[model samples]
Target: MLTHPSDPRRVLVERSDLDPMALPPDLRRYEIHLRATFDWGRAYLTNPHPDLGRSGSVCPFVSASLKRERFFLAVHPGTPSDPAEAVDTMRFYRDWFLELAPRSQPSAQITTILVLFPDVPQDAVEPLVDDVQAMLKPEYVGQGLMIGEFHNGPPAKSGLWNSDFRPLRSPVPMLVVRHMVPTDYPFLRDDPEQARMYLELFGDQVPAQLRDQVERERAVGAP
Candidate 1:
């Protein structure tokens, strides 16, 4: 169990260190949800599936993240119904994610932070989780990081290879934060500012198919 530097009450556990019995009494209640999240990562994210419509695992980074002990999970202490509060909570984790160990390159690329919300009800998923994601995404992308929303509502963001596959769906509502990689252009291309940010970070490394779009957006300048 690793205690967050800034906030001692907030605890983060690596995938390999996840053990319900080891958690403090106050944190034990989250064990079931945490276990489910761990299982889901192994069974889905790290494995290749016929329905994924691609040759690789659902998330190309998960296997390496798990192996390197860079994948972290934490149950948020508060479940704020208001989008404003939720946005603030997610932003805190965004900054915390940058401060966590393995801040260097290569290893840092695979580091991931998954902040789960077990107390949030199914009805509130959209406003609290999805809307917060939309509100904070530009800031996250501009900083060369990615923030993703997942919930049992089965988020509308579909898989790149399979249109019908809702890859963001998770057993629990959560927000995932990770450093942006060259392969993330697909998610940034739709927003001109985000596209320019992506081009600035990745340069000619942007996929050939999207280079024209990025160049066109760059010509238009920041909007």
Candidate 2:
């Protein structure tokens, strides 16, 4: 976790008195929600890509990286009504996210960051999600942190399954942050450049068997 301080006043998770569920000290809130949403727990998090981890659940690997201090979740309720103001807020989030990474440690657990824009429609949330990704991805290469948005928007096609089940689909507009891994190639393959970048980022840590696919992705991405 980052040693840098965040203003407790502005953050909801810090204000546990207001919403105890914001960031529970124990398994209370998180476990309950995990059970309540089968798709997120049973399907997405648990299911691994055949191409990636044989047949193991993706959750255990990711969960291993996380400790009680590593978890960070932010619930933002609104997107400003004004267009320009909304953009400003998005940029602020992008900047804040960059700093969320621990200063002393270049690498850490997934350090999940979930931004909830519940009042905002999918249309609004989707574009903002793109904007944030565009703004931060390049700066984060090889840095080990991964961030994503989950809104009422369209479901992201599964990288692990043939079915149309969208693991990223959620009821509210939420953005997630976590540590990066070599197995993420499935998600980056569609964008050849991103795939190459991801390969470069993970470097030699990529598994021996997956080298073919990784090199293939880099080759495909080459100009």
Which candidate has the top score in lDDT?
A: 1
- Clashing pairs for model 2 are 110-179, 150-174
| Candidate 2 lDDT (Cα, 0 to 1) | 0.52
> Which runs of model 1 end up more than 4 angstroms from their true locations?
101-103, 208-223
Number of clashing pairs per prediction, in order: 0, 2
For candidate 2, write residues 112-173 as lDDT tens digits: 55555555665677777655555655445435456565555554545364455455666555
List per-candidate RMSD values in Å. 2.3, 5.9
Q: What is the alpha-carbon lDDT for the whole of candidate 1?
A: 0.83
Task: Give the total clashing residue pairs for model 2.
Answer: 2
The superposed Cα distance between candidate 1 and the true structure at residue 206, in angstroms, equals: 2.0
Candidate 1 total steric clashes: 0
Give every collision pair in model 1.
Answer: none
